[model samples]
Target chain A: MAMYVVGHKIPDSDSICGALAIAYLKNQIGEEAIPTRLGDVSPETQFILDKFGFTAPELKMSYAGEEVYIVDHTEKTQAPDDIDEATVVGVVDHHKLGDLTTSTPLECWIRPVGCSNTIVKMMYDFYNVDIPPAYAGIMMCAILSDTVIFKSPTCTTADIKCVEALAEIAGIEDYKALGMEMFKVKSAVQGTPTRDLVMRDFKDFDMHGNLVGIGQLEVIDLSVFDEIKADLAADIIKLKEEGKRHSVMLLLTDIMKEGSLMLIASDNETIIADAYGVTVENNEVWLDGVLSRKKQVVPPLQDGFANA
Target chain B: MAMYVVGHKIPDSDSICGALAIAYLKNQIGEEAIPTRLGDVSPETQFILDKFGFTAPELKMSYAGEEVYIVDHTEKTQAPDDIDEATVVGVVDHHKLGDLTTSTPLECWIRPVGCSNTIVKMMYDFYNVDIPPAYAGIMMCAILSDTVIFKSPTCTTADIKCVEALAEIAGIEDYKALGMEMFKVKSAVQGTPTRDLVMRDFKDFDMHGNLVGIGQLEVIDLSVFDEIKADLAADIIKLKEEGKRHSVMLLLTDIMKEGSLMLIASDNETIIADAYGVTVENNEVWLDGVLSRKKQVVPPLQDGFANA
Candidate 1:
C-alpha cells in the first residue's frame, strides 16, 4: 500500500515542508510514501517550495480507505475529509493532539516541540539518514515560519537547536536573511482575494460545542489591515452566517510589531472582549504580543465558550 | 510537579495494572509519579491486585491542572472529568487514539498490541528496567484479562510474546490457570446490582452524533444471563431513559462457550438485527464466536446507526 504523507488542511509553511521532510525520511527507511497535501499551498509555503526547487505535493481532498501518514497536525477537523476512515499508519506532529481516532494503534510521535520539522530533524538523527541540502533548507524554513524566527511563544530550545543545526547542514551563512525572505513573502498580500487571504492559514476549533474558525494573515504593515478590514469583516460575517461556525475571526498579525489586529464576527461581543480582556471597537481590537493562535486565541476562546 | 499516572474510568484489569506498571517504570527512570485510578477497581482487577499484594490506587474524579501521564486509554470521555484542562506529560496506550488534546506536545506511545501492559513490558525492555515479580504477575494478569487468554481478535504476536515472557518472569508454570483465576473473578457477578453489573465494564461511544454505550461481562456459564436478563434489560432501559445515551447494550459473554448473549436497549431494534443478521428475541441474541466489543459490537452498531 502506498502511504500518503499529508499535513493539515490550509497548509502552512511548516505543515507543507514538514510533510516533505517526513516523506523523505520514510522513504530512506524503505517505505513507499508520497508527500501529499489536503489544500492548496499558501503563499508562504509556495515560496519555500520554489526556494527549495520542490513541487507542491498532489492535493487530496479525501483519504477514504487510503493508507496515510500524517504530519504537522492530528486534528480530525484539520485533516482530510475522510481522515477518520483512513488507515493512518503513522503521525509525526508537534501540536496538541486533536480528536483524530484511528482504527488500530499506529506509530505516533507527538513532541511538545514548536515546529513539526524540528521533530522530523530528530527522526533523521534517529535513522542516521543524511539530510539533503534542499530538504534541510525547506525544513529550516518551516521551523523559522512556525516559530516566527524564534520569536513565537511556542519556540523551545529544541527548535532553536534544530534551526542552528539545520542551517549548518543546508550550508546557509545567514539564517536570519532566509527567515526575513520567508516573512517578506508571507507579508506580500496586496492583490490576493480577501477569502483566500483569510483562509490561507485558517483552522477550525470546537469551542465547547460551538464550531469556531480562526484565520491568521501576517503582514509587515499594520496599514494592510486598515485597507482590507471592511472586506475581512464582511467575509467573516458571511462565514458566520453560513451556519458552520458560532464565531469566525481573522488575526491580521503585524510580524514586525509582534501583535495582531483581530477582526471578529460573532453573536457575543462580550465573550470576545472577555476572552482577551480587550474592548471591541467596531468589530476590531489590537491584541498586543499575540503571535501564536494555537496558544493565545484558541484557549481563551475555549474558556469564553465554557463560561458562556 | 509530580506526575499522576491514571487509567480510564470504570477501571479494568489492564487499565489498573497498566497504570501501576507505568508508574513503576517512571519511578525507575527517576520520575515522581503516583499511580491513580479514575474509578473503582473491578473484581477481576481487584483479584490481580490482591494476588500481587498491591494496593488499589487513589481514586480521582477530576484532573484540573495536575501533570498527568495516561496509560491504557487516551479517550477524553474515558479520562478524568477535567482531563482536557490537565497538563498531560506522557501516554502509553494500546487502544485507538481519542479526543485527548494537550496544550503542548508530550511523549506518546500507542501500539496495536492487545493489552496496554504488553506495551509497558516493551517500555520496561527499552528502559532496561527490571520488572519485579509482583509487577510482572499483575501485568501478565492484565494481558490475560484483556486478550481473553490470547483469544481476542485484538491480540497480536507482541501480546503472545509478552504473555510467555511475563509468565516466566512471574514464575507461573501454568499461565492458563492464572488466566482462569482472573476470569473466575470476572464471572462472579451473582450479588451485584443490575445497574452496577452493567456499568462495571461499560464504555461510551459517539456513533455519528449518537451517544452509544456498550458494556461487557464475561461469565464461565451462559446461564447467568438467564438469571440477570430481565434485570439487565430494566437497568438498560433506566440508563436509556436517563437521556445520556441513544443506545445502551450489554454483552453477556460466556467465556467457555465463546459466545455472547447481547442484551440491547435502543429505539431501533431492526438496526441491531440488521447489523448482525440475527433476529432480536426478547431484546437479546446470541453472537457466537464474538468475544470483542471493540472489534465486533461497536463497529457494526456504528454502521447500523449510520444506516438507520
Candidate 2:
C-alpha cells in the first residue's frame, strides 16, 4: 500500500510534465502516484507548470528511500533514504539510462518514440480525459522544450501524435503561428539574474568515458555578460576549487555573427589549456572563433581528459 | 542581408534551440537566422548547453525595426515589434494562435500538433544531417520540455513522428528508457532563496476580464513555505504596491493531501473575507478544503477582480 513518486533528472518540461501526467493517470488506476522532483526546475519548467496550472512539484534530493518510479531521465534512482530498498510498482519514461539499481521488478513503460509525455497523452486520449487548457499549455511546452518545437533530432511519431491531440484539445486557431509567438516570447530574456542565467542553457558530455557537465551562456549583446563576466568567472573559479570534473564554459556568442568568444574555467587549467591552446588570466580566459562547442571544444576536451 | 534574432519571453529550450534550428534551416534556404535572446538563460539552461557543448544565445531585446524572413514562430510576417508586424517566411510551429495579428499573409505551416523542434527535425530529416550525440540529447530535451514527454494535450502526431525519427538519428538504444531517467530527475526548491521559493514555482494568470498577471507558488511541504511565510508575505506586499492589479494571491498548496495554505496580497483584502470567510492577517492567511488554485482560489479572485 505504498505510493510511488518519480520524475526525470535535470528536469525540463518533459520530466516535470510527464511526472505530473503519469501521477494523474496512476491516480485513475487506484494507485497513489506522487509526482516528485529530483532537482530544481528550469525557467522553462515554470512556464510548463503555469501553462498547466500544476503547482510546481516538491523537490527531493534523490529517490532512494521512497517508493519511486522513473520518468524522462535515465537511471539515477539510487536514493537510499527516501526510495530505499523498495520496488517501483509502475514506471513510464523516455530517455537514455544512466545510474539505476533496483532489487525488485516493476511495471516499466519505456517508449522509444519522441517523449514520455506523448505516452501519457496517448493514455489520456485513450481514456478521453478532457484536456484542460493549462495542461494543453504544459504539453505544448514539453514538446517545445524536448523537440525544440521539432527542430532537434530526438522527436518521434508518438511525440507528434500527442502534440496534435493536445492542439485539438487546446482549440488552437493556428498552432504554427502560436508556436512562433511562444518561442519568440520565450527567447526574450533581458534582465534575468545571474543564477537564472546559469540554469537556463546547459548540456552533458562524456569526458574520457566519465560523465562531465558543460554549460553555455549566450549574450546577444556581450555587454550584458561583460558586466557580469567577472562574477561568472569567480563562480567558475569556486567550482574549480571544489575539484569537480565539470567544466564551466561560457560563449559570448553573437547570434547575428558566426563566431563566438569563449570563456572557460576548470580545475585542471592545463587540461583546458592543452585542449584549446589558450592561456588563462586570473583563472579566466576567452576563446574566439568558437561556433560549435560540441563539434569543436568538447572533442578537444575529451581528448585532453582521455590523455590525462 | 540583415538577420533577425528572436527569443521567447522566458526563453526555454525551445526558445534557444528553436532559434538555432530555425536559423540553421533559414540558412539552408539562403537567409540569415540569428539566435537571439531577450534575456540571458538560467543555470539549468546553461547545463543543457554544457551537455551539448553549446552557448546560450545572443540577446535581442525585441523584433522591432527588423527585416527578415521569420520561421517556426508565427505566420504573421509583419510583426513590427509585436506578434503582428514581423515578416514570416515560413511558420513551422506547434502552438495555438492567440490574439495574433497578421498584416499580410505568408507561407505558414501552422500545424496543430507536435513541437516546433519536430518541424525543424522534419527539415533535418529531409537533409539527413548527422546529429551529434549531444545535439541529439538537446533534441530529446526539447521534446521532453514540449510534450511534457507526452503528458499534456498540446502534443500531436507530428511530434511523435519527430521523436521516432530523432531516436533513430540520435542513436538512442531505447528512447522510452531514457525518458524515464530524465523524467525521474526531480525539480523542486529545497534550499532555494525566499524570493526564489515564492517566484520559482509561480505561474502567471490572465484574470478573466483583466489581463495583468497572477502567479501561484505551491509548497508541497507546507512547513517549508511556513518557515518563510512572513518574508513571503512581505514580498507579496511589495508586489501589490508595484503591480497594477486589484488582487494578487499566492496559494501555498500541499499537493500530497490536496489542501492549500493561501496567502493574499492585494488592494482588495475583503475578497478573502467574502470568499472563504477568512480574515486577512498581516496580508497572510490560509484556506481550508482548498486544493486546486484554478478550481477554487482563481474563481474568487476573478470575482473579486471583476467586481472591483
Candidate 3:
C-alpha cells in the first residue's frame, strides 16, 4: 500500500514541500507514499509549486481521529476526534507541544524548528534520501517561508542548518531574495476579492482572558493596503465576532523591503503585544524584521503568555 | 492509555465538536484521546469553539506520525517521528482517505462523511457518549458549516442526518437564525484591510492556456467594497505578473441579501467561461449560485477546454 501525505487547509510553503519530502522519504524506504495538497491552493503556494514543478494536493479536511499523526501542532484545546486512532505513522512538527501523549510508543518528533521541511532535510541526512535539486529548492523555499531565514521567534539551530543544506543543494546564494520574490508575487490587488486578499489561513490562540486569532498576509505595494485598510479592519471585526475571540491579528509581511506591516484590529493592544511584541503605529502593527510568526513571534509570545 | 485524536486546521464547528464526541466515546471505552487543532485558527473558528466552551488549540505545522490518530484530517503530510515502533491505537475520521499506514496492528476508522464531526457524532450514537446540550448546539453548527445547511458542493446525505440529530438534541428549531447570525458575524467586514476586504484564501486553476488565481471574499456591506473595486484589477495583475501567472479571477461573494456579486479582472474572461459554463458579463463574472470550483466550475471548464 502506498503511503499518502496531506497538508493542512490552505497549505503554505512548509506544509506543501515538507509533505513532498516525507512522501519522497517513504518512497526511498520502500513505502509507496504520494504527496497531496489538502486544501484550496493559494496564490503563494501556487507560486512555489509551479516554480519547483510540483502539484498541490487535493482538499482534505481534518479528522481529529482516535489515532492521529500530529504534525507541527500541539494538543491543547484539541478535541478527542482531533486524534482518535490506533495507528500513527509519524509526526514532524515545529511548534510547542500542547499535550502530547506520554504513554504511546510512537516515534514522536517535535522540534523547535521553523518548518517541517527542515526535518525532511534531516531525514535526507539520516535516511540518505537523494535530494533532487528541484525538490531541494522547494524544501529550501519551505524553510525560508517558515523561518523567514531564521528570523522568526520559532527558529532553532536545526532550522538554520536545514536551510544551509537545502540551499547548497539548490545552488542558491540568497534565500532571502528567493523568499522575497515568492512573497512579492502576492503584492497588491489588480482585482482580487478583499476576502481573498485578506489572509484566511488562521489558527486560534488564547491570551490572558482573551481569545486570539492571527492571519499572515503578504502583498506588494503596501500603499494598496492603505486603500482597503478599513475593509480589512471590518473583516477582522467580523472574524473576531465569528471566531468568538476577543482579538484578531493580521500580520502583512513584506519580504521585498522592511519588516512586516501588521494590520491589527483588536479591542486590546495588549493581545497584539502578546502575539507580535510590536506596538501599533496608527493602528498598523510594525514588527521588526519578523517574517515568520512561528519562528520570530509564536514562541516568544507563547512563552511570554505563559510567564505573564 | 490515553487516546490520540487529531482534527483539521481552523478547527471548525464540525471538527471541534466532532472531536468532542469521539473523545467522549473513547472515554466511555476507558481511553482518553484528545482532539488537537491542526493549524492556525480563524475568527469563525474561535467563535465556534467559544460558543461551545472549547478553548482554541495551540498552533501546529503538520501531523505525520505512525500509530498516531486524526479526526477531520487524515492524509498525513509529515509523519510524527517514529511510527514503526509506536502501537496503533484506534482511529475515527471523516475525510477522504490518503496515505495512512502502520507497520504494527492499528485500528483506523475512516468515514467518507461530509464532516469529521458528523463521524464523531456517529461514534457518539454507537458508544452512548453523553452529548452535552451545549455540545449538541456546537455539532449543529458544525453540520451547518460543513453542509452549508444543504447548500455546499461537498455536502453528503450523512451530513444532513448528523445535523438533524444534533439539531433535535440541541433543541434548535430555527437553524436559519443561527446560520444568519453566523453569516452576519463572518460577513460583517466594516473595518477590514483593503487587501483583506477583497480576498483572503485563493487557488490557481488553469483557464484556457493561462493559469488563473481565483479568490472569493464575503462581505455584508455593499458600500464597504465600493472604494477598492478599481484597485482590485490592478492588484490581481501585479500578483499574476509577480507569480508569472496569467488571468487572476476574483469573485466578491456578497453574503448579504444581495446574493453573490462577482468581479473577474483577468485577460481570460473566455477562459473563465470555458471553465465556468457562464460567460463573463461587463468584464465581471455572473454565476447563478455556482460556487464550487472543484465540483461545479472546474468540470465544465475542463470539458470546454477539451472540446476547444
Give the candidate number with the greatest lDDT: 1
TM-score (C-alpha) between model 1 and the true structure: 0.82
lDDT of 3 by residue, B61-91 (tens): 3333423455554333322334233444555
For model 2, residues A1-308, the per-residue Cα lDDT tens digits are 54656564456567788777777777776777777776677655775566556787778655444566666543332222444345444455554223343322233344445566776675565456666666676776677555545543456766666777788777765665555555444445557666466545544544545545555543334555656767666665555446454566655554334355666665567788888887777665556555444445655776577669
Instruction: Say which docking band candidate 2 falls in.
Output: incorrect
Share of reference contacts found in each model: 0.64, 0.00, 0.00
Global lDDT scores for all candidate models: 0.85, 0.56, 0.60
Q: Which stretches of candidate 2 lie over 4 Å from their true place?
A: A2-4, A62-64, A75-86, A89-93, A111-114, A122-133, A156-158, A176-191, A200-211, A216-226, A250-263, A267-308, B1-308
lDDT of 3 at A178: 84
The model with the greater lDDT, 2 or 3, is 3
* DockQ value for model 2: 0.01
lDDT of 1 by residue, A188-242 (tens): 8778898888788989877777888899987777786667778888998898888
**Residue B10 displacement in candidate 2 (angstroms):** 54
After aligning candidate 3 to the native by TM-score, how far in Å is the CA of A94 from where it should be? 1.7
